[model samples]
Structures are given as structure tokens and as C-alpha cells.
Target: MYRVSLFPTRDLHLSDLRVALINYICAKQTGKHLIVRVEDGDKAHNIDGKDQELLDIIALFGISYSHLYYQSDNFKYHLQFASTLLDRKKAFICFCPDEKATPYDGRCEHLSPDEVLNNPNPFVIRMKTEPISDSFVIMARNKYPTYTFACAFDDMLQGVSTIIQDEAYLENSSKEELIRHAIGYDQAISYTHLPTVHESEKSVQWLLDQGYMPEAIANYLLLLSTPTPTEIFTLEEALSWFDIATISKDSVHFDMEKLGFINREHIKKLSDMELSKRIGYACENIGKLAKLYTKEVSTTLEIKQKIDVIFAKKEPLATFEAESKLLQELIFNAPYFEMFDEFQAYLLEKSNLHDEAFFKPLHFWLSGSVQGLELALMYPLIKNYLKEIVR
Candidate 1:
């Protein structure tokens, strides 16, 4: 069985996605159970519903798990393991002030039992670690099990054969192993530590809101500074070609430009009706308009921004302010025409505004830009809603 831990201290980051994806792939390939350990024991730092939110994001990526466990739910088991260590003289009670002692300082390791019981100050439990693994706090003064203690015992009790975690937890992982060995639960386990994506601190939902598609985000995470048979693929499609051994040991940085390109490619895959509905419209013409704008922009939000300007009230260029006013009245009373050329010719002759004078304000009135898709290409799709587009 493979396990992944999700901490609710913050929204799931790109590194988290990497962890989830790798675990899912490995478990699926081997036909073993995958478990999700929600490390939400730190109530003070946890965000309400963030644990569920992280799971939702993982689900969106199509990762499957056999069981879900909350670290807090196994509170009793964690305490039992902590006490066993204490009874064996492998751990001790420390009366150090909460803010006074740093991790693994061993300041109170020598305290006698009488001195410990006589002390009235709040105390935390610290493990007496071997030289290879540094000592650490097992249980806090609040009676809550520290992450290392809770996670170590849970993994041992639950039969997790493999753990995939970010490199940031490298030291903590070794300490968890130390605790397990100290407690005499010595079943062999495999650990795979992944490098963090240097600049991906935003939550998964943040990326979605910024208009990056889930497929695109998955594609990027799987291939960032790594080799891939192809540049773009769905999460499921990567399963066949994805090899766990190919993961890089060094960290990689996020590249917004490459992701933008991937996002654009995914956008192109959406149906016209789907595209229309995504930007608050249902008409196919609106969909077509959005797709046309895709050549110039990379995200759904960017496409909508360009499409929205056509329906918004006009904002003419200052250089063509006079031409704008003249063209506005000419367009309001102009006869309906099926083509941009026909409508344009009528305005050109009626306003007697030649070349730049005729076209610049006309461009702004219709699309709110002096430079954009040729008016000829845009006019037909929008002609039915010309009045709405120009005003």
C-alpha cells in the first residue's frame, strides 16, 4: 500500500499535486491500496474544510485511494506509543516553556522522575533519539500528539508499505523512522521524497480561478523539468508511460509561459457550446468568437476579456475622437448589411472619413480596439448583434 499526507495548513500546492499523482500512478500500476492521511492535527493552523478541499482537488486530478484517515482520529494510539517510549526510558517529560525550547534541544532529558512530577509548569514529551536520527517532541503540552509521533504510529498500525512526501519533510521522515524503530514496529517501508516546485505556493483552486484547466495543470506537474513522450496529455493518458524512477532528484521552478501554452491547447479542445457557457454565454457564435480570440490569448479569462469588449460601450482612441463621434451616428442609422465590407463601405462614403480616419474609430466602436482581428473577419459573426456591439 502507498500513502500520501495532505496537510490543511494551506491549500494544496503544485508539489502536492506531484506527490498525489506519483502515488496514484504507483498504486494503480501495482494494484495495491492507496491511502490518504489528512494531517489535520494542527487545529490552530488548519483552515476550515481545507482538508476536504485538498481531497476534492486530488479527485479532480483523477487520483483514487482506498481509505482516508485523519491523524486526530487516532489520538489514543499515538499517546499509547508515546507512553511506551517513555516507559522504556527512551523518552522523557520536559517542563520547558513553550516558547523557550527549540526542537531537539534535549534541555530536560536528564530530569529525574521526582523533579518531573514536582514541576507544575506545562510540559511536552520528547523522544531520546539515536545519533543518526535527531530527537524531537512527540506530544505537546496541549495533549495533542506532534506530527512525527502521530504519523509514525499511524503508518505502522495501518500497513502503509510506501510513503510519497515532498523533500521539505526529509528530516521529519527520518525522525518518523527513528520513532518506529524505537517503538519496535520495524516492518520495512519504502520512502520516495519529491522535490518541491520552487514557485508554486498557491492553492489548486487558485490556479483554476486563474483560468488554468485541470488537465493542463496535471500535464505541467508531470513534466516540469522531466522528460515526457509528449508535451500534453490527460492524467489518465500519462499512466502507461509514466515511470516512477524517472522523477528528478533536484527541484524545478514553475514556468507560467509553458503552462499558458498547455492551457491554451486544452481550451482548444473544449466544444463550442462548452466554450460559450464557460464565458457566460450559450450562443455558438459567441463560442466561435471566443475561439477566434484564442490565437491572441492563452486563457479562458483572456478570451472572455476580448469578447466582452465587443459588447461593452465604445471607448474610441483619442486620435480618432472626432471620427468616433461621426461614425457612431452613421452606424446607429445605417442600413443593416450581411458583410463587414458592405457596412464599412456605407460608413466610409457617408462619413467621408478616409482610411485611418474611417477605420480607426470604427474598429474601436465595434471591438474597443484600434488593432485586433480584421474587421472583415469579425463583422459577420457579430453583425446580428451590431447594435449591442457598437454601443
Candidate 2:
């Protein structure tokens, strides 16, 4: 199993999704279990219901897991392992009062058993700096098990054979390996460190709320600095071709423009009825109108906004106000025609106005925009709703 550990301390970010995708792919590619472990051990930092929200987001992106757990649930095992390491002399109880102390001076490493028992000062459990690893706390002054301590033992206990972690945690990799080694676990654990996606204001939820489809987001994320057979694919489809080794070791930046293009492509793939529903109507005509907006926009919200402007009543520009009133009056009394050309020819003859004078104000009156989908093509679709469109 390759497990993903998420801390419920902050809002979920792109980096979290990257790691989760790697962990999920590894398990599916090997016929093993995908374990999602919420590292919510720090009670001071855990958010309310954020853990469940995180899982819901993952599901929204279509990532399924074989197992789910919380790191805090294994508190008993973490402490038990700490005592086991202390008894084996692979770890020592440190009396160092400085919580920020690092590269420890080994002052308390030699206290005799009676001296340790007689001493009343509070202390922490630190793994001995073997030739294999540096010294760090397995238990902190607050009595909470440290991340490395819990993660290392959990991997061992859960039989996790691979770990895809961030490059920032490169230093912790050896410490975790040492913890397992000192505890006599010889099973090889593969470690692949990926460069982190730097922090940004746009989070995963932010993208969703902006009307970017989940598939498009996943598609863009999986394509970042990674070569694949195609530019667009769903999370489920990516399972067939994803390879963690192909990911670039150098840090990658988020490209909003590239994601916008991918999102546009995904939007175009939607059916007419589905597209219309996104804009708050079920009629295929509205959906057709929505698709026309796709030529200039990518997200569902943008397309919906454009289509909504057609029906929202608005006054025409001052220059065209008189002509628009004439056009609206003409449309109100005019009988419905199946074709736009017939409708336009009739208006031209009745109004006795030339093409630009007639069409520009007519366009502005119908959709409240001087530039957009050509009036002729859109007229037929909005014909039945003339009473509502004419005002």
C-alpha cells in the first residue's frame, strides 16, 4: 500500500491533490490498497469537518480508495512503539528544555536508570542519531507523537511499501527510514520525492466554484510537467497511462491560461441539454445558446452569464434607442416565422431602414449586446420566447 496523509490544519491545495493522485495511481497500478490517512493528530490545528470535506473533494475528482483512517486513531500504537524504541536503546529520553533545539548535544543520553526515575523534570523521546539518521523527537513536550514517529510506524504496521512525498520532506525521509530500521523492519520502502507546487490564492475549491469542471481540473493537474499520451483525460482514464517517475523533479508553476484552454475543451464536450442545465435551463435551445458563448469563454459560470444577458431586460444604447423601440414594436405585432431570413426581410421592408441601421439596433434590442452570436442564427432559437424577449 501507498498511503496519503493529509493534515486537516489548512485549506486543501494543489500540492495535496498531486500527492494523492500519485499514491492512488501506485496502488491501482500494482493491485494494492490505496490508503488515505488524515494526519489530524495536532488537535490545536484540526479544522471542523475539513477532513470529510477533503475526502468529498477527492471523490469529486473520482479518486477511490481501499482504506481510510486518521493518524490520531493510532495514538496508542505510537506511544507503545516509542517505549519499545526506548527500551531497545535505539532512542533515548531527552531532558532538553528547549523545544527548538536541533542537532542535539546528547547531554541526557547517558543518564542511568535510577537517575532517570528519580529525575522529575519533564522530557521528550528522541531517536538516537545513528550513522543512519539524525536525532529528532519521536514524542514532543506536549505528549503528542511527532509526525515522523507516527508515519514511520504506521507504514511499517500497515505494510506500506512505497511513499511518494514532497521534496520539502526530503530530510524527514531518512528519519522515517531510520525509525523503521532501528525497529528491525527490513522490508524495502520506495521513496520518490516530488517538487512541491508552490502556494497560491487559487485553491481546488476555488476552481470548482468558478465553474471549472472536476475532470478539467484533474486533467490540468495531471498534465503539469508530466508527459502523457493526450492533453485531456478524466482522472479514471489517467490511471491507464500515469507514471510517477515521469514527473519532473524541478518545481512547476501553475498556468491558469493553460488550464483555461483545457477547461474550454471540456466544456465543448458536454451535450446540449447538460450545457443548458448548467446555465439554469433545461431547454436544448438555451443549451445551444450557451455553447455559442464557449467560443469566447471557458467556464460554466461565464457561459451561463453570457446566455442570461440575452433574457435579462436592459435598455438599448442612446444612439439606437429610437430604432430599438421601433424594432421591439415591430416584433411584438409580427407573427412568428420559422426562419431568421424571412423575419429579417419582413422587418427591412416594414421599417424601410437599411441593413446596419436595422440589424444593429435589432441585435441590441434582442440580446442587449451589439456584438455576440449573429442575430440571424440566434433569432430562430429565441423565437418562441419573443413575448419575453421583446419587452
Top candidate on TM-score is 2
User: lDDT for every model?
Assistant: 0.84, 0.83
lDDT of 2 by residue, 1-391 (tens): 7888877887778888888887887788889988889998899989999999899998888788888888988999998888999999998888879744866777888889988898899989888885323578889978889988888988888888989877878888888988999988899999998878764568888988888888798888788879999998877788899988899887778888888899988887888898788769999888887777778798998887777777888775678777877888898789888998899888888888776778788887677688788887788678988768777
lDDT of 1 at 309: 81
Backbone clashes counted, model 1:
0
Off by over 4 Å in 2: 118-120, 131-133, 316-319, 349-360
**Candidate 2 local Cα displacement, residue 184, angstroms:** 2.3
Off by over 4 Å in 1: 98-107, 315-322, 329-338
Model 1, residue 262: distance off in Å is 2.0
TM-score of each: 0.89, 0.90
lDDT tens readout by residue for model 1, 221-316: 988756789988887888888887878898789888999999888888888889899888898888888888878988888888888888887665
RMSD of each: 2.8, 2.6
